[model samples]
Target: MALSLLTPNSLTKIPLTKLRFVPSLSPPPPPPPRAASVSFRRLSIMSSSNGIKVGAAQMTSTNDLDANFNTCSRLVQEAAAEGVKLLCFPETFSFVGMKAGESLQIAEPLDGPTMRRYCSLARDSNIWLSLGGFQEKGPDDAHLYNTHVLVDNYGNIKNIYRKIHLFDVDVPGNMTYKESDFTTAGTDIVAEDSPIGRLGLTVCYDLRFPELYQQLRFQHNAQILLVPSAFTKVTGEAHWEILLRARAIETQCYVIAAAQAGKHNEKRESYGDSLIIDPWGKILARLPDRLSTGIAIADIDLSIVDAVRTRMPISEHKRLESCQKISSLSSL
Candidate 1:
């Protein structure tokens, strides 16, 4: 079970000069470079009762920050043209440093230049963005936080979630990645309201834990779950779609997954199959090519979420059973 070698594919780069971004209205001045508290900013267009269009982007990111930004900018324009209100990006969207200590060397705070450009892009495009798995500078110099940022259409920082489940696996003769070596685990579970619905934020490794998804649905009342990942080819082929569909069915929530695809570097490659699954475990959208750089477009309807939950009514049943078990234990 040796690690398989992947040949890097040449992706067509869309020049920023050719693309156009038309804001719906005048965008406000850029906010100060500081991390804003967790809050939701609703846009007038997002408040409509109809279903909202969203996009999940898949791309191969490298150590070059400028190139990655260009790729993302192009996707934003394409999504906006298709009337997408929200677009989600994959983990490590900015830079994927293959070497040790490289990410820490370039890690920036929330208010850093890297984030400023993304904020400006969102404002100019007038589209909400979910930037998952940014290497954020931590409290100390030795470590960094794998941060996920949600920005509003107006370029406001809505909320941020650091990845709590650090990937520390050592499969003999296969893949061995120790994410905890350089990254610090996040302490909080973050959820926020958006144009689509109540969004539950979780990064790559968080997908393996069902309890996290259950907490998001039962406790946080999250209607949509976002899983941004860079899954290895082996594991992704085995469980990616199955786990995503299972989470959607059990939670009765929409699941949108943005993924990193193709060979990023000689030593690293990702299994890319970006998907958007509905509450009923149906795949609404997915990229035709598993290893291409593009977005999966879909419409998120809250009405469908309600319809599925109403028919199944699993949440209520689970609560009732828990209460009964507690009452029985007390009597004993």
Candidate 2:
């Protein structure tokens, strides 16, 4: 007997299980160069708290932490001014170094000045923040983790998801990065509560794994997914948009991806095109390519999640669990 896997319409990219994770590099979060890298509503197309208004920020984070904070401070103010309840930032939002190993020196503990600043922003603005990826000082003396954090509107932390999947790849002549060299991998999955809905936090490379998303959306009941990334130019152009839209469509949840754009350092260039996608797979708001520092805002409606899932019942029809087992089902 043989087992067969079923996939949705052809619009979906590679068969569900066949997709591979392609890794990329990120710039430091504090200053320009490369550092780092939401949804809703039927609210007025631009700004409001009438519904869930979210912001996606695209930045070129550099080696300087102070400079990067200035950029983030400005964007956070802009988002708050618009009455955005939640803002999603790209990975490495706090610090990226001139080179790879430099992150070791800059990595900070959760209570460090970098995180304190983020908490202050959320508290002052009364907004939730998906403070994507940061260089965290690991338990050991020599390593760091690509950590993702969720801060509530009142400036309290609700979740911390270290990147479970690290970006370690070789794009041959275009680029080759081994994130493991500078950062460690996270071991658990986080689907936590937020003002809008249950939020699932993931980083750049994690986008390629549909299984992880399945667990987030179905098992954990996450209604919105946040991917803060600093995807490299080569892969971002080829796979970023499609991957994001597909994830939204599959999970029937709002997908917010804030990305790193432009050249970050002499060694790296990020693909910018940060986006806010709806549950039905529409691109709601997106930052233009190559923008140095910009915020793309949009409305997010949770009702749409129910509507999409009810209309197309994909989760109910799936035959395989997140990790497929060859012998889970015997011959019919």
Candidate 3:
């Protein structure tokens, strides 16, 4: 029996009786008095109703797919060990710095090998996971999409959001990313019911578009916004934290951003600074540059979304009356 490729199902079939079964039968301790299992009614009353702990994982990955998977697995395990209900990883975590047309070679079917691996990890750790920008093979194999997927503790995929806004910028002296050259943009916005709360999903460059977040927060009632980014060091230094905090303050939603930080492929440098921000625009936990792989755990109190909105009443203040003038002018 080869131990390397054995699965749980395969291991279960081998009879234990066929193998040596050593038993310590020295008068098994007198059966302890049976204890009644607590009813669901009692358990619900004792659990906290308002808060859930979530984690953001920062991964520094290279072109090696196996190494990247292993690193992500370890970080997820660390987060699960710390009792985090959900964990998120940075963008393009599986393969970074691959040339223009090279991603196609690595792209997998939505239910293919990569997802199976992720599903297994999610079930084993019993933690919800969101990995940024998996290379997903499109319909008919015409194009590949940079897709973000959410998996529940049961290893079931809850939602998939392809990168709605591709990175088509060409910055002088810094970086030039023309994602549109290889990938097609996704049209739909994805918001899903998660264990923590309603979650709105976005990838790296999509963070720049405020309208997306606005629609997600106001229309969809998203409580948490997940941004898995691989921002360049130049832009990240300038706008990463500020933009993340601004989104939290504007939407009144907890922002969990896991970013890639440091140099990769002997050329490109990513701005790390993975952060977890509260609805009040306060930084709860942050992983600074060069931290590599780690978890940023934060208590996400969904109540804060209401509390801040109630105190400020901004959402209500944007009444039809205020927008009427703008609408009337546009109509004319």
| Worst-scoring 10-residue span by lDDT in model 3 | 38-47
- Poorest stretch of ten by lDDT in candidate 2: 14-23
Model 1, 1-332: lDDT tens digits are 11111112221111222112223122223323322221111121121135688889988899999989998998899889889999999999999997888899999999999999999999999999999999999878988999999999999989999999999997554579999888899999999998779999999889999999999999999999999999998888778888998999999999989999877788888887788887877566676556667788776778767767876788877876678899999999
Alpha carbon lDDT of each predicted model: 0.81, 0.77, 0.75
Candidate 3, residues 1-332: lDDT per residue as tens digits? Answer: 31111234331121111121112112112323322421110000001234577877776677778888888888777777777899888898888854656677788887999889998999999999998889898654557899999999999998899999988888767977888777878999999998798999999888899999999998898989999999997898678888998898889888989888666666777877677777767666654323446776666766666666776677777676668988999999
lDDT of 2 by residue, 2-28 (tens): 111123432222111212211113221
User: Where is model 3 more than 4 Å wrong at Cα?
Assistant: 1-50, 139-142, 288-290, 320-332
CA RMSD for every model?
13.4, 9.6, 17.0
Using lDDT, give the best candidate's number: 1
Q: Please give the RMSD of candidate 3 to the true structure.
A: 17.0
For residue 80, model 1's alpha carbon misses the true position, in angstroms, by 0.6
